[model samples]
Target: MDYDIAIVGGGPIGLAFARSLAGFGLKLAIIERQPLAALARPDYDGREIALSQRSVRILDDLGVRHLLPPGGVASLAAAHVLNGGAKRALVLDPARRRRELGKMVSNQDLRRALFEGVAGQDGLDWLVERDVEGIAFEPASAALSLNDGRTLRTPLVVAADGRLSQTRQAFGLGAEMNALGRSMLVVKVAHEHDHGQIATEWFDHGQTLALLPLQPRQSSFVLTLGDREIRELCALPPAALAAELERRSKRRWGSITLLSEPFRYPLVTTFAHRFVAPRAALIGDAAVGMHPVTAHGFNLGIQGQATLARQLAESARRGSDLGDLRPLRRYEQRHRLLCRPVFEATNHIVSLYTDERPHARALRGALLGLGARTRLPRTMIGTMLA
Candidate 1:
């Protein structure tokens, strides 16, 4: 085998996985289709990732946390959830001992940091601008044929590709997919009023909105609506879009203007039928795609990659075949336990908030009220976020 392990993506999660296994002296290769320049200088894609304390700690360990630009990591003091212009809200923050809930960082920064951390690492190869055409597994190794007419072998293969993973499908693994029939419109906006580091999730009639606080007078507006309506909103001129956002939030930010081009993404979620098969294991969005409402997708991916890497490292240390199914199953079991409840919960949250019926509205109001009064649910949510 040319490499001990081959990661079939070069995104943050994939780089982090390779980094985790590098300490074990395993030769690694990243099979990425993107050009190295794009991989190295990731553009701001109007997406921000909410990093949990655990994720931050993992990045810190990987030496990637230091790459964050000043003012890029925003402190989230608390998150408030309101239902249909309700006077009351469900407030969730960190535990009593913590001053902040968590941190938020731009996706571009995270990807750049992760790439820089591993770009010069030993025993790792960058197979950039290359696509995996086929993958075949033997008893001792997996052989991957690249589109460039080159082939490489690795004892184990890890899939960190996004939700629609070609690698996963090539392995004949199945996924339970959900097309939520909704889309989210996201844009960076400059506001006249400061957000005070408070994030707001408003479930208004026929709309679900989330304002993620950024530095001072900046925030990311995430508007969830039907596909057709969101397409129209995405097509709106910046001025009109800003006006709509300001009106949607009831002038919470006083007045707003677009800071970046708005982008629209179909809100889809996926859960792989299995996390591992034979010499391969899945991580990141490939294993389970979460609804962004919970904002745990990337964090969970980072943590899950660590889980599988530890098992792979141990197998390497023991001189066992790295593709041995034993460790793969263990990693799968652990990750499944960690992600199943959250996946179900995120789906429920999406379903509940997106329903516009009167009864559903009343139920949402009552649930918000109950959540505000209940300590357990709030604490559970806080624990998940932090």
Candidate 2:
């Protein structure tokens, strides 16, 4: 085999996984379509990742945490979930002695940190500006054909390509993909009033709005609406767009001014029917693409990669076959147990909150009220956030 293992993505999750295998003396390959320079210093893509404590610990273990910019990390002290036209909100506060629910970091910053940690590592090949055109899996190894007419053989191949992973498709793995008919627009904004380091999610009549606290006077504004509506908002000039945002938010944070270019994404959630196939296994978005409603996408990706890395490292230490099904099955079962519940619950939440029927609205308000009055539910949510 040309390599012991081959990872088919170079995003944060893939990079972190590669870094985890460092010092194991395994010949690894990271095949990425993105250029090397972009991997080193990724541009901001207007998405902020809410990382869990477990995820932070994983990054720390990988030696990537310290590489993040100090100012780029924001504390999520509390979260408020509000229903349509309701003054009351279901508040999730930090547990006793805990200062924050989680840490919020820009996507680009995390990517850069992971890339920095993985680059120049021993016994690893960083193949940039390349695409995996085909894969031929054998009982003993897999042959990965590059777009440039080169084939690399590996005992195990990991698919972290993304939600729309072509590698997973090539492996004949089916996924349950739900394309929600809404789009999300994210922008950096400066507001007059303080956000109090609180993240607020509002489910109004026909839209969803979230304000994630970043700096003292700045926050990330996330608005979800119909595709045409989002396009219209994106088409507006800066001043007009800011005014529209201020109006839509009901001036909750007082006046708002746009501070950065807006970015929009169509909301889609996906889950593979299986996490592994033969000599190939899936990780990151390729395994489970989560809805951002609960802000678990990035965190779950980190957890999946870490879980797979641990299993693979153990296999290497035992001098076992790198493509052994034993370790791969364990990784799949554990990751599936960790992901399935969250993925289903998030989809349910999105369904319930986004339903605009009268009965649905009433039920939503009742659920929110019940959650606010119940300490157990709030505590559980807070614990989950922490």
Candidate 3:
């Protein structure tokens, strides 16, 4: 076999998985369509990732946390969730002696750090600037045919490709995908007032907005709207855009100025029916693409990849084949147990918050009130961050 395991996609989750497998004495390869330079120096795409404590510990173990750019990771001191135009908000704060709920980092920086951490790992090869044209699955091994006419045979193949993973489809795995007819516009803005390291999410009538604190006066302003509305908003000039944000936010953060280019993404969430098939396994977005509303996408991806790596390591220690179904099934069951609840709950939240019906508006407002008064909702969110 050309390698013991081959990973498709070199995104953060994929790279982190490879890095975690270092020193395991298993030959590995990371196949990415992007060139080496792109992975080495990723461009900011206006997306910030909320890192749970477990994710931070995993990155620390993989040696990618230290590679992050200075001042890039931000502390999420607190979070406030508001409903409609109501003044009452549900506040979530860290427990005693805990300085932060979690950390925030840009997706670009995390990817770059993972790429750097995986460099110089022994028995690992990078198959970059190439696409996997086909895969032939056999009982003993899986053979991947690249666009460059190179065939790689490995005992196991892990797919970390995006939600619409062609490899997952090729493996005959099915996924339940929800393509919400909404797009989220993300932009970094410099506000006149201090954010106090607090993040705010507002599920106002007809729209959803989140202000993620970064540094002191900077924050990531995320606005979700219909597809057409978002496109029109993106076409506005910088000054007009900032003004519109101020108006939408009711000048809560005082004045806002655009600090970076706006990035828009159509909302989509997916969950695979199975995370394993024959000698194949799916990780990252391939296994589950989460709605960014709960900010669990990459966090869950990191957890899933780490779980798979542990299973593989244990199997290897037992001198079992890397592609053994017994271990792959264990990874599948464990990851699914962790992913399904989050995926379902996030989708339900998006549904309730975006419905805009009179009943939904009333119910959500009541829920926010309940959350503010009760510890259940606050505790749930705190646990998610931890």
CA lDDT, candidate 3, residue 69: 85
lDDT of 2: 0.91
Residue-level lDDT of model 1, residues 290-329, one tens digit each, is 9998789998999999999889888988999999999999
Instruction: Report lDDT (CA) for all predictions.
Output: 0.89, 0.91, 0.91
Over 223-331, each residue of candidate 3 has an lDDT whose tens digit, in order, gives 9999999999999999999999999999999999999989999988889989999999999999999999888999999999999999999988888999999899999
How many residue-pair clashes does candidate 1 contain? 0
Error of 1 at 76 (Å): 0.8
Which digits, one per residue and each the tens of the lDDT, describe model 2 over residues 1-386? 89999999998888988998999989999999999999998999999888877788888899999999999899888899999899998998777767788888999999999998988999999889999999998889999999989999999999988999999999899999988888999999999999998999999988999999998979999999999899989989999999999999999999999989999999888999999988989999999999897898888888888888899899999999989888898999999998999999898888999999999999999999998888876577666655
Minimum summed lDDT over a 10-residue window in model 1 is located at 377-386
The clash numbers for all candidates, in the given order, read: 0, 0, 0
